[model samples]
Target: MDAERGGGEAPAAPRDGEGRFRRRAFLVGGGLGVLGLGGAALVAGPGGVRSAYTRVVCGSTPEPPPGGTAGRRQGTLEGRRVIVAMPRAARDTVPVVVMLPEPPGDARAPYDLYAVDRYLAASPGGFAIASVDGWPSADIVGALLPHLEAGGLDVRRIGLLGWAAGGAEALRLAAQLGSGVVRAVAATSPDVTAARAPLRELVDIPVWLGCGERDDRAPQTETMLKGLKALGATTEGGISSGCQDTAYRRRVLPEQLAFFARHL
Candidate 1:
């Protein structure tokens, strides 16, 4: 995977990725409050769903993620960055979908504005996030183990999210981790071509696919849902109402959050 934002009209790629730090500073230093602590804690609840997930998927944090000087990039050892607007009294450690362009202004500005907490509430698996910017898969997944051990996250439960090409990565992670991924919510996925076998090597992980009905990108996203299903990957689809830029006018986050609630 090139593991970097590929297309878009974003003017600032934020080589520093410190733009969020500036915004983070303006937040007055709030703690990772327990809004979705309820969700993360539900990992071991009744029903075979929770127990089965932990026994197979959850693991120890692999290594220490990178950390460095202020006013510079604090490399996301475990994930990427994207700007998220939380409610006034928002809590930390919520279950995040971990989309690309994580919490800072990145190349994908149009896509970055999707995961605002009010717009997309957390699911049962805690609302904490772990994003990736076209970085190495091993680096992203590998660093997460240490982040958990250091008390950065409960870690046992989390979900993944992405847009456009990022959606391809989201599904690949689910397939790579198998039962480890609680659920995947992706829109305008690019990996699902009608003739290719991109996700055929995966297992039965429930995937919620979305697309803008009028967007030309639907071909790949649609093909993915169909192909993954044919491959017995337990995949599904969700179509946003408006076409192209206005696709979000259909309120994708809410439905995705709901889908995660049921599966994660």
Candidate 2:
């Protein structure tokens, strides 16, 4: 996969361990508060919705921290179910990242469990990462935001990530929310046309556009990337592997999270 920095032209590869260091920084200092000894607790909400509040500790994982309890809490936003992961420390306000999953099926599943856990554990400052079973609806996310804020998430530092149709929703929401709140966005194989126009409105937001090399929508992703660059938005990441493929997410998500760490 080819990853490029913002602007119309591509820059040379990062020298030495710069790229690696950035990734490590994302895992270490990515959150809103400095890491410290803390615990996580699940704050149970109504109807089986889960939410978590944690006191973050230093390093990549949260278990090493002493004193704070760790767990997930269930909660609902406008009737939509969500899964949230809180960091180990909760003393300070923290940023929150929302990952919009693919549409639901017969069985309900946790959203981005693997990625969310990894991010929260590695975050230097605690971050509350949440996700729903379906697309990233503005109404749903908007509702979720308050609940998370009330639980200690810093609404000011927020990020959005989505897959496929969910990806389009992230872009649309970023445009609607504007730079005031949304700091970064990552959309994989997004149906670019579904995003509302005034697409130029996203010029100020840093977007990580990901698509599979074999995806039919690759052209759309390319088109959107070109348009974003032309409009002056900082666009990073180009394509991964697979065509509208889920396997490619593993390759793309870390980069997206790192982008969010850089901006949010």
Candidate 3:
């Protein structure tokens, strides 16, 4: 079933040094090493198109939202219960944003790191954002997306947004989905070191990364920049002076949305 929600006021264009970042551009092109995992094979195709064997897939069955609300739904992905948030919008077909959860292990981790309500408040009907409960693995993410696609969200204009550990997932999904499936990617306080192989396959997409100046993860942004550039992605980002981790996301989400507005 399609989910619907009210839209929020889009923020005014950010000003220089006022929650907006300067653009730093770079480019790189290279081939990625092939590796097999989870019974998946690797087959190189023409025009950089890799076969499904190179893709990691998870099994899932779609179920209706609980309590009659389209925003919250539960489904079984490879036997594990996965929760997804679908924004309620007036339009029948809305743009989609797949949000990956924070990396497992944090004591204070919320049920959904993407914060459905926060997004609803920011750009309610603008996009149908799905935040799923699962690790940032290729199989799991691959499984959840089809269900949303089936629910009427537009896959052609898809976007991926994540923070911290989830940021790694966003990058991997962008790479795995290849050049056509994903239009843009945004990461906040991401752990760039996670999942490097798949990340090397990314090509011809726009990526926005935000980190905190005081946060220790700031340096990793450089590492990510180099990696995305080498993979032939157009990249831009900035470091918020006093933000860190969760706080960094809070300040960056607006910028992230703005970036998506431009590219998606």
* Number of the top TM-score candidate: 2
For candidate 1, give the lDDT of residue 254: 56
Candidate 2 — which residues are off by over 4 angstroms? 1-71, 105-115, 123-126, 133-138, 194-198
Which portions of model 3 show Cα errors greater than 4 Å?
1-89, 105-114, 194-200, 226-232
- lDDT tens readout by residue for model 3, 126-201: 6655655445433544566676677677778888877777777788778777768888888777776634535556
| CA lDDT, every model vs. true structure | 0.47, 0.63, 0.58
Model 3: which residue pairs collide?
4-88, 4-89, 5-88, 5-89, 7-125
Q: After superposition, how far is residue 15 of candidate 1 from its true place, in Å?
A: 45
TM-score of each: 0.53, 0.65, 0.59
Error of 1 at 118 (Å): 2.0
TM-score of candidate 3 on Cα atoms, chains taken together: 0.59
Candidate 1 Cα RMSD after full superposition onto the native fold (Å) = 21.9
lDDT of 1 by residue, 1-264 (tens): 233465555465665657775454333222111322233334333333333333223321222112321111124443453233222223454344455432232523433344234343332333444433443344546665344325344344556665655556666666676665444544444444545434654545667787766667676667767777777876656554445432352256556656665665
Sort order, TM-score high to low: 2, 3, 1
Q: How close to the true structure is residue 54 of candidate 1, measured as C-alpha lDDT?
A: 34
